[model samples]
Target: MTSVSRYMSYRGYQFPMLKYWSPSLGVTMLGVVGAILFLAMTLGPKPYYWPTDASYGSSPPIATRAGWMALALLPFVLGLSVKANMISVLTSIPHEKLQIFHHWTSYAMFLLALIHTFPFIIYHIDKGDMVKQWKTSLVYWTGIGAIIPQAYLTIMSLPFIRNRFYEFFKATHMIAAVVFIVFFFLHCDFRLSSWDYFIASGIIYFLCLSFSQVRTYLMHGIHTATLELLPSGLARVSVPTVIKWTPGQHVFVRFLTPDLHLLTAHPFTISSVYRDPDQAGKAPELAFYIKPRRGVTARLAALAAKQTGITKKILIEGPYGGVSTHHMSQFDTILVIAGGSGGGFSLAMVDEALRVSGLHTGEDESGQESRRRLQVVFSTRDTPMADWYIDEIESRLSQSTTLPGSDNGFETSVSVHITSKPDLTRSTSTLDSEKGTAGKLPPTDITTTGSFSLNIYRNARPDIPGLVARTVAMAHANPMPNGKKQRIGVLVCGPASMLHDTRNAAALAQKRTFGGEIEELYLHSESFA
Candidate 1:
């Protein structure tokens, strides 16, 4: 599909305000439900049983059909579980993007398994052979064993439980999945086509797993990572390597330290843009800004606190899930919204904006009347984090201006909303030292540097809807030189509340595109918390 059609399909609606699924997802789900219903109606037991006088067996057909349907879903569940898989390769959808479908498919399979289980019990109990079957039949034993772990996997994967006990969940989820799959394969007991489904699932999972392991160990390999604790209570991990990645992509980093996450790999968004070493004459670095919550992060933070700069051996698995650079470059305006540790996400986008605008390339402007605009809206409660963010922005803007053939008309603006009171008792010197400042925090005073402007708001939250509306309004007010309507790209990375507000705002703005007020408005959001 074309990008425009894809964007429209994926765009969300505000009505039924709590609904999170896009039009595309809703339609896909509807199709899945419809297919399930059709299958159940067509293949379900006609009389629910055959008479003892008849030639056919007495067991209900619904149980066998449900079991087959559940078996057919195994390959899909396994395919979606892997980061590197044929589904993602064929569909051009990231593994992370397929996560929702994976979850739903697993739920469907679990439901089918339950459906498959109870019918056998009900039928055998009515025939007065249920207790005998349980005691004697291997099929009953294997089926029960499979369902028990399947139940654990399903229940523990619920958002609240999974999020609260992530480390435990992650460890046990794999073990349970293995046990369930093994028992399920045994439960089939050489049934025609049942083994085929298991074989397909196993092949899909193994190939994906092998590819990922090969990529991680051979292609990417191990690298040293410097971990520094930022004043905002975030661990800043910097790994200099020959590997290159696009803006907004994330990597799964396995820290090879016993006290830290020795076995498990944690995902973190890459905070810096990749520059080709051959072109730049230096190895590019992958940077990650991580907020400490629990488990691995908390341990990393504790280590970072004791030592300002610590080094560890790490292996990175991917450069996955980012907006296409070609797609992003088509926009006339770029608006980025971020909150807290989402500052890192915003920085990578800003870097890409500068690169796409030819600021990094030092290319001469094409002499258009209107400039390409890049606007950033950040909300945070940490004073030090706000300072650090401003410093990073200032450094980038300063570098852009110094580059040869920089565009004079390129406009950039930043609005930082600090949602908490600044601690007056904290030593300014300590803060300055951490940020490499001149023994003082950055002034709260509004500053305009050439084409760049910065605004700081103290003890207040950002007006998300207002910001989005104003941006669209400004685009409408200023027509492009070529007489084409403006195309805007809106990227947001923040908390769920922030994402919800931004999504609604963008949805409202998208209506203007239909009215000819704009050409297109594309929104991409990532939840940070």
Candidate 2:
């Protein structure tokens, strides 16, 4: 889908539109729920009445139908719960992107579960055997057992609670899920075909779990990760490995250290592009730029602060979820926007752009001269982070400039904005901001480094919409030589606020594409928070 359709929202409800579902996703989910309800209501007992036979007890036709419907949803819910699964492999959709569906499906199952439970309770009460059934029936006990954990899983999984108590929630979520599944299986008591659902779900969940475990422990194996504290208070993790990963992908790192997130595996985006060891004459390294928060990052930062370049044994899983390299190459122009810690994401995109355009290898592709343009816009409140970013950009630009085919017309530009007040006392040679007549921090434009231009602004925020519009306008101004409309790809990684702005901006830019001014306007957004 184009950015326009993906980010489309109804008037007067912009905030709610940003919560989870896009209009397309919302409609798809609505259809799913509607179909479930239709089947439940249509196939069930007409008045949802309790059977006259006392032997039937709480096993009314309607209750059985509701239970069966809930059972049918098990496979999908379980399949989407894992990081590595057949669903993702077969569908070409990443596990993370399927997370929203996983959550919604579970909610639907819980609702059906409630529907299945209430009927039994009402039937038992009407028959005046509620107390007897509660005391004697294993089914009643096991049903309640399953529901307690299910309720906990549902309520605790809410965004606010899950994000606020993430460490606690993550630790307990797995345990609770196992308990709920076990009790749910027992509650079914091998009722015809019920065991089938359990087996399906069990297989799907275990297979994915086993694959992830094997990849983490046996395939990628254990490696030493060196942690260094940057002046920006960000932790830089460097790991040498033969494993290759696409740009914009992330890996879950499990540190083998006690009292320091020993049991948890935290995900970090790889900031460096992978190259062949044989070709480069050394093992390729993966780098992560992590802003210290709480838990694992906080502990890692503390250790790095004590002694720079501290090494820790770590297990890595994945390299998952990235825009396809081929898809990215199809774009005539690539604009990357990042905020704070999202610098890593932006850096990776820039690296990929350079590599794809043959600027890094100095190999000129036939008929590809001046074919691609890359723009990077990064905003941060910290000056040190901005400085670090500037240095990294300069290094890349310098390398490209010295290459044989560097002047192939593959244009690159970087803009860094620091929202906080600049420290005038710091000694730096790159600062080129003109002195303000009043007490104001004016925008600073750093001198062009090598063949690329680098601009830095102090005490200012980026105009996200303006940047997007200008990039699209530039692409429109330079029509493709092939007589085809130009394509622009925008990648945004930042906090929710920044994502919201970029999302809307990209969506609005789609108007030009729809009006035949361009071929396409694609947007990929990642939320760092």
TM-score of each: 0.90, 0.89
lDDT string, candidate 2, 450-504, tens digits: 4666667788899998999999898888876656678888998898778777877
Candidate lDDT scores, in order, read: 0.80, 0.79
Residue 16, model 1: Cα distance from true site in angstroms = 12
Query: What does the lDDT come to for candidate 2?
Result: 0.79
lDDT of 1 by residue, 260-352 (tens): 868788899988998878888999999999999999999989999999888999999997888888866777889999999999999999888
Q: List the residue pairs that clash in candidate 1.
A: none
Model 1 CA RMSD to the hidden true structure, in angstroms? 3.9
What would the TM-score be for candidate 1 when compared with the true structure? Answer: 0.90
What's the TM for model 2?
0.89
